[model samples]
Target: MEKDRLVRFVGKVMEESGFKVYKDFKTSRYIIDIYGVLPTIVGDMGVVVACKNYDEHWEVGLDVLKEMEMIGKTLKASKIVVITTSYFTNSASNYAGRRNIKLIDKDGLVTIAKKFSKKENEIYETNVIDENEDSETYIPSTKSSKGPSIFHAGKRSLSKSGRSKSVGRNLNLGNFMQGFKGIMSNTVALIIIVLLLSSLITYIIGLFNKNTALIGVSKILSSAILSYGLVFYADRDPNVVLTKGTIVFFVSMIIYVVLIVLL
Candidate 1:
């Protein structure tokens, strides 16, 4: 049988014997081969079986046997059955005998499976943590009744380091509405603002004068500034400024400078 079919068969046997089975039981990173909760029905007991599909005559390794033994004890299982198509090594059999784990070799599996084909009664209980509780029920170790220990200090310190880290987060979220409005507005006044700023800065740098270079640079800067305003407006709408947008702007700026200097 396929692994899943074999597991299903084992689980069916367990259920018939009156046990609650939990398949793919994750104790840690790896899932247990077959972890099940057996009902406490008088003489009929539940089991956890680490099922293996190896060929006959192959011996079950001691380490594999030990790991399953530990998991069985941890889960409070009455018995752990290493159900394999293969027989157990002498050391593995001795260990299982001492630990009280039942070995279900290929032949034993079919026999035992046929025996536990009836369901039994089981008791189930669960624990839950209460979220809403007064001080009478659950209290923090800290003596202060004001609030949580972490927020014990009276005021939030707005120091240089704190503000520096907080500024980026606050700007991204708190100023979102203001930034969105500024980016969307098509007031030509905003375009004029960018144009005037760029032109005045270039002029102050002595990069522009009464010559053709001055006029040419001014026009180029003015065009870029105007485009930036349009880009900002488009950004507010569904109009996207892709990754290429910044590259295009930078390249245009470089070309404009080279044209003024050479041509």
Candidate 2:
């Protein structure tokens, strides 16, 4: 029957993804056409396959997918994979997604199969995956950072390049904002610590020295403090340098004036 050829075809494709693939695999309840073990970074994940080669341009529907889902439940499979020669209907895909079933049509299978020009034993011997790393850079036993895709190859969604190398990656505005905020916070913290420490030292010096001497010292430090903020801010962007400099200048001046009057 057509189903037999489809099972064999799916088995061949699964082999490329570093699976020990077998056709007509039997479980406790029913006979699964294909079953395989996918070695991943987290652990070995089980894949149960349902292969269909339709005679017509039939859209594999949700009803068929539900059967695969039920079968997957019994087998405790990580992925319930449905591979078809014909394309899937929209409803079928939606339903499969809801059930967490992976769907692969004729084109996806062929593309995946072609990538496996290497012999199955060679792949088994060579590939090794380690702690949650990029599957693209995986050697022996690796899994994608995201979940597994329908194909054995990494499935970076919205990226048309499938297994092909891409020139760029998506920019994340949220991450950029978070990093910027952290830098600003650290800069402000450093300024606070430095200014506070300087004030404490000035206070101790004032306690020991005469008012005239303290006033002279304060004046010199005040000029330096004012210029420090300006110079610190001058190089970078519109960072918190201006604010830091202003605070340092004003605080030093207030301390300087207070000592001159009180002493």
The Cα error of candidate 1 at residue 73, in Å, is 2.7
| RMSD of candidate 1 to true structure, Å | 25.1
Instruction: Give the per-residue lDDT of model 1 (tens digit) for 155-248.
Output: 2224423433443343333234323333333334344455555556667656535576776566666656555555544342223333323433
Off by over 4 Å in 1: 41-46, 113-263
Off by over 4 Å in 2: 117-263
Would you give me the overall lDDT of model 1?
0.52
TM-score of each candidate structure, all chains considered together: 0.40, 0.45
TM-score of candidate 1 against the unseen true structure? 0.40
Clash counts for the predictions, in order: 3, 7
Query: Where's the lowest-lDDT run of ten residues in candidate 2?
Result: 163-172
lDDT values of the candidates? 0.52, 0.57
In angstroms, give how far residue 77 of model 2 lies from its true place.
0.7
lDDT string, candidate 2, 20-127, tens digits: 786888877777888887654334556688888874488799888888878876776656788888889999977765555779887876665554443343334333
